[model samples]
Target: MKKIGVFTSGGDSPGMNACIRAVVRACIYHGLEVYGIKYGYDGMIKGEIIKMQSHSVSNIVQRGGTILKSARSTEFRTKEGRQKAYDQLKKHGIEGLVAIGGDGTFTGAKIFSEEFDIPVIGCPGTIDNDIYGTDFTIGFDTAVNTALESIDKIRDTAASHDRIFFVEVMGRDSGYIAIQCGIGGGAEIVMVPETETTIADVIKKLDTGLRKTKTSSIVVVAEGDEEGNAAEVMAKVKAENPKNEYKVTTLGHIQRGGNPTATDRILGSRCGIAAVEGLMAGQRNCMAGVMNDQIVYTPFDDCISKSKPINQDYLKMMNILSI
Candidate 1:
């Protein structure tokens, strides 16, 4: 391909700028021209395409969020909108594409490639870490670490006041962040969407801790938990035990900001380079992911159709260690 396009869609996450930097440099290193598609598919239809040079991406590897920016385009889901996007690509002489984002981004790329006979490679860039192909998606480490740091600070106050704290972390449909951060933060209890959780179970755990004279306790709840959000869960727990002081802290967009961790930077860089190499190798409609410390390509259908299950062993460990 003489010229290729790259863009980030869906929610923004840390390490995306690093990925964009890697894609620009890798394409340039291979003597290929790169075009930046601002605001993802929406921009593609609007013809918001710009030429990218190595200098355009300089000093962006350490930045948070995406330099190209991102947006969800309802128009892109329709046949006419996709045709406009494809025409825009033809106008810019873009032969291949590199898409960065979560499941929705890949789904759109998969359909567009098949319809237009274009080669497209995907990079998992969501903080949710729910993609099936990779062990961990880009920005997951940074987000988990961010939540863990906040939980640590909350613990300090919980101990001082001798109270119970309900800390909520983001993970729309997955418990990867809540499970990992709960264990890392030494939480007394953790509620995830993958498993059923009840307020009675929470009160029981707290009652046991109180009997042992535990000065403080923390329960980490995933936002998508079956029982409800952190606030709803806290309300139920408080109703049962009116005498105990309770507080709720939701780590909302904070987890999606800040500089990426070393692991995330490395992962994003590797995936970005692999995406360009995959397109050059005549591979299309696939995602570049790191598995077992090696780069691997997975079909977009498999990556999005299947669900990535959380490790039950970690849940078992959490139970054993909490006691």
Candidate 2:
């Protein structure tokens, strides 16, 4: 408990630096030596750890992405790799750990915590917002806004050109960003992976709303929708409705970058401090998350095994509100 480590793994996300800042400062405030692990679990095996000071994390709260950096460590998947990482921790006297990332990060942390004597606490840092314990993940709000901003701009061009636009947002495993931006951008149709909506349905809706009545319109689709991304779906729709003008825009990693919004900074800060405090409280193999505006810890197994479902009402709202 006197010395601890923190690292960000898997894909990087906005507000992660704020989380790292909070974690480093909080540990230092509680009179614990903090170590920064670079390049995630891979860094542990490589012994790429450095002691952090109060100033180490200063002025990073406004920044996007993680200061500690993140990566998926293929080597860390093996038992031998994990043992090496454990030995390095023992060498550095790091008693506990705070891991930041999405489900992949938590899955690794859970296995490592169970295998070794060291304890670990995770922070949800994915843009997908699919983690079960918390109402929102660290980067989801920022990602949604980022994608929405693009949709707003695309809407202007969509109108100017008198064309239908298919805008793709992130979320391969979840449809959060697409659903949120779909409603917020006032799209004619929204497509997600969770629902039973089909490409045929999208085409029919375009015919009903875009082909005849409206000169321009938008359709927001998640990357993981049953048919395909925005481009593929647009192709199918274009083929069926040959007279309709169409354009495809994949928002891609633009949603992943950019400085986090005010909401994300607060969430990251809260989760970061909670993680450090949770470790001191003898809580292990769990995640620090904000549920209903209060800090709560959920077991890692539950966070990983249970999937957070999207609001069905949000999907339904699109049906009534969009038309």
Candidate 3:
């Protein structure tokens, strides 16, 4: 019987458990032994393995975060650690691997698969939605929803205080979350890494809004932006308009944990099953992603080499809505 192992690496996302459940169920349905690798690549290096039964994964598709938990490991970046992971895989008689994570984790998996000659399938699970090949990564919808809710909450305070608040949302290199939340929540200025924005331009916009509108303005800034930290930008804006009171809030890991929204749950299930199917169909060193509403397997080499570009339509929507 074919033996398969699944692990979640890097930062944990909302739909990871759903992906794991689909992987395990799909493997079992196909008469393969499914093993859960705990703590991601670190767990593999440490030989942490658990055989998963159907009952073990029951009702986890609706859950947030990873059932196996997740951690980053510099050891996993080294050849020695990869050798240990290979040794553990051989000891357990694992024939294939399903890796769920972002770019960094996929890089490690690509190295391991090449070095060990083991088939590995990847499922994108980052909230950042920056992974290549996939139009939407697991947890992105949930993260956008979580961030929008936080913005709504902060809006209540901002309105009462007549304040301008700079809110920071997570997105390493992509601005998916920031754009979506800013648009959904009707922010005054949306700052994203995808587009360049000068402090002068932002101030002019905010000043116009303050002078013309009674409602407090919201500026949604992606963590990785040209203007630096959202908090510092808020300070500068406040200094320029000392008469206008403002506040700053940074939504960090909170965006990474939450019940997977309906879209995330469905996407995770589809992508997870697609990962197993890719492996069984002899698609080696590829990642499973949804394109044009159909599952497709992309070579890991291409996935690691480039990232999915930020959706310009969504950016346009944000701009229109902000206006």
Candidate 4:
């Protein structure tokens, strides 16, 4: 393939610009023309692509979010829309492709490439860190660190007021952030979606702390936790005891912003270069990820369809440490 294109889709995450920069510079270093497709698949279908030079990605490594931007495309779900996107790529003389984003991005890349016979590779870029194959997604370290900083600050207020703070962290369907921040922030309890957790269980954990004469506590709750958001869980617990003060702080998109941490910058950059190399190696329909400090490739099907399970041992260790 003489030319290739790259884009970021779905939600914006920290370190994405790092990935974009690496892809562009790697392409130039390898003597292949590269184009940046703005707004992801939506941009591709709309023909919103532009040639990218080495300078196009200069000084963007520390930036959060993708320089190419991101958007969801319902139109790309249709064959007609895919056709238009294919025609647009062909118009630009693009051959192989690099996709950046989470499962939605991989699903689209998998389908588009298979249907059009275009070689495509992916780089995981979600802050949620839900995708399988990779130990951590591109923005996870930065996001977790962001939430941990908030939890640390909240702990100060909780101790002062003798209050229980229920801190909600981002991670749509995964508990990676909550579990990590919970342990790192020294939370009394953590509620995640991966394992069944009831409001009663949380109350029990809090009660255990209370019996120990603890004045204040932090409870980390994943946004997707089945027991509900931090606020909802706090309400249930408050109704049960009706004596303790409680507050809920949802980190929301703050975790998705800010400059990526050193770890994320490295991971994103590594995956970005690996993606270009994978495409050049004629490896199609896969994602490039770093595991155990080594780059590994996983098929898009596994990245999307396979379950990425959280380590229960980590949860157990957190519980042991909390009490």
Candidate 5:
């Protein structure tokens, strides 16, 4: 039987463990020996490999983070490092590899597959959900929900004190989490990187809302929002309305770590199993994504080159609801 290897690279996400479990179990169920790589590309370079069995992955479907761990290794950028990883693959007779990560992780997998003829299949696992091929990545749902809950909690305090609360959510380039939570939690203002939010725009929106009836406001800001940091933006707003009162809370790394939500668990499992099936079918340099409620394998090159834009239709719906 051919041996298959799986690893999670880049930042840790809530549903990574679920993806790992799904990949391992899927491979083993199909009579393929499964090997787990620890610490992402760093482990592959250092040959930190472990064999995985059904018992090894038991009850991990609901867990958070990756069992194999992850890292951003500069060494993996070098040809020598990749060569070492390829050599390790040869030594272990791992003919196929399933890599779970964002775009960077897929870049490495693409190179390894091309250079050594080792089949590699990638699964979109980032909470950012910025990957092109997939409509939704594994951990995005859970992250959005987590942000929503935090915003809800913050709203309680804002209402009681008749204050404005600025809640910062994690999203470097993409505002998927911020947008979802903003709409879900009934935020008064949302600052996203996709569209630069000006101080005037915020004032106008909040003034409209304030004139209506609400005594307080909740503003959801993506970490990459324009006009400097979210704290600074909030400060500027506070300056305009000193009596408005406002507090800034950065969710930071907390959004990245948590047990996979129900949606994430199910999504990760389906994506993982689909990845193994794709590789077993001799597919290489492809990413597994969910589209139209079905798993579709798209070429890695297409996935990397394409841009996944935010759903403006949903954004418009959110704008209506916010009013």
Candidate 6:
């Protein structure tokens, strides 16, 4: 491909700028023109394509969030909207695309490529770390560390007041963040969506800790847990044990910001480079992913259709170590 385009779609994640940088520079290095599509598929539909030079991505490897920005396009979900996006690509003479985002992003790219016969590649770029193809998606490491840091701070206050804390992290439908942060943060109980965690189970764990004379404890819960978020879980726990002192904190978007970690930057760069190289090698409708520490191309269909289950081993280790 002589000229190609790149965009970040769906939710923004840390290390996205780094991914964009790698795509831009990698394309430029291969003597190909790079175009940046602002605001994701919406930008493509609106013809918001801009020529990207190597300097356009300079000094962004350490940045958080996406330089091209991202948005969910309700319109892009329709056939007419995708036609408009394809027309824009034709107007810019863009021959291929690199889409960076989570499941929704890959689903859109997969359909668009089939509809237009265009070459497209994907990069796993979400804090959720739930993308199927990659062992660890870009921004996951940074987000986990951010939540761990926050939990550490909260622990101090919980200890000072001799209270229990319900710490919530991102992962609306997945528990990768919660599981990692729970173990790393030394949480007494880690609740995730992959496995059912009941209020009685929580109370039982708390009672066990209390009987052992533990003064303060942290329970990390995924936002998508069946039992609800930290606040809801804490409310139920408090209702059952009114004498217990409990506090709730939703980490919210705080885990999505800040400079990308070194691991994320490196992963983003590797995936970005692989994406452009894959396009040059005539790979289409695939995502660039790192599996077992090696760069690999995964078909978009598999990525979207398959579910990446959380490591049961992590859950087991969390249980054993949290004691």
What are the RMSDs of all candidates, in order?
A: 0.7, 1.0, 1.2, 0.8, 1.2, 0.7
Question: For residues 149-199, could you state the per-residue lDDT of candidate 2 as single tens digits?
Answer: 999999999999998899999989899999999999999998888886887
TM-score of each: 0.99, 0.98, 0.97, 0.98, 0.97, 0.99
The models' CA-based lDDT, in order, is 0.94, 0.91, 0.89, 0.92, 0.88, 0.94
Candidate 1 positional error at 75, Å: 0.6
**In candidate 4, how many Å is residue 141 off?**
0.2
lDDT string, candidate 5, 60-149, tens digits: 988889989998889888889899999998899888999999989988888878887888899899999889887899899899988888
Give the lDDT of residue 150 in candidate 3: 94
Predicted structure 5, TM vs. truth: 0.97
Which model, 3 or 5, shows the larger lDDT? 3
- Indicate the residue-level lDDT of 10 in model 1: 94
Question: lDDT at 85 for candidate 6?
Answer: 98
Return whichever of 3 and 4 wins on lDDT. Answer: 4
**Candidate 3 at residue 230, lDDT?**
93
On lDDT, the stronger of 1 and 2 is: 1
Listed per model in order, the count of residue pairs whose N, CA or C atoms clash below 3 Å is: 0, 0, 0, 0, 0, 0
lDDT at 123, model 4: 94
Task: Give per-residue CA lDDT, model 1, range 126-154, as digits (tens).
Answer: 99999989999999999999999999999
Kindly report which residue stretches of model 6 are placed more than 4 angstroms away from their true locations once superposed.
none
Residue 215's C-alpha lDDT in candidate 6? 92
Q: Candidate 6 overall Cα lDDT vs. reference? A: 0.94
Per-residue C-alpha lDDT of model 3 across residues 1-323, encoded as one tens digit per residue: 39999999988899989999999999999999999999999999999999998898998988898999898889878899999999999999999999999888888888999998999999999999987788899999999999999999999999998888999999868788988898799898888888998788788888877678756889999999878879978877766767777788999999999899999998999998999888898877889999889898888889889857777887788667766
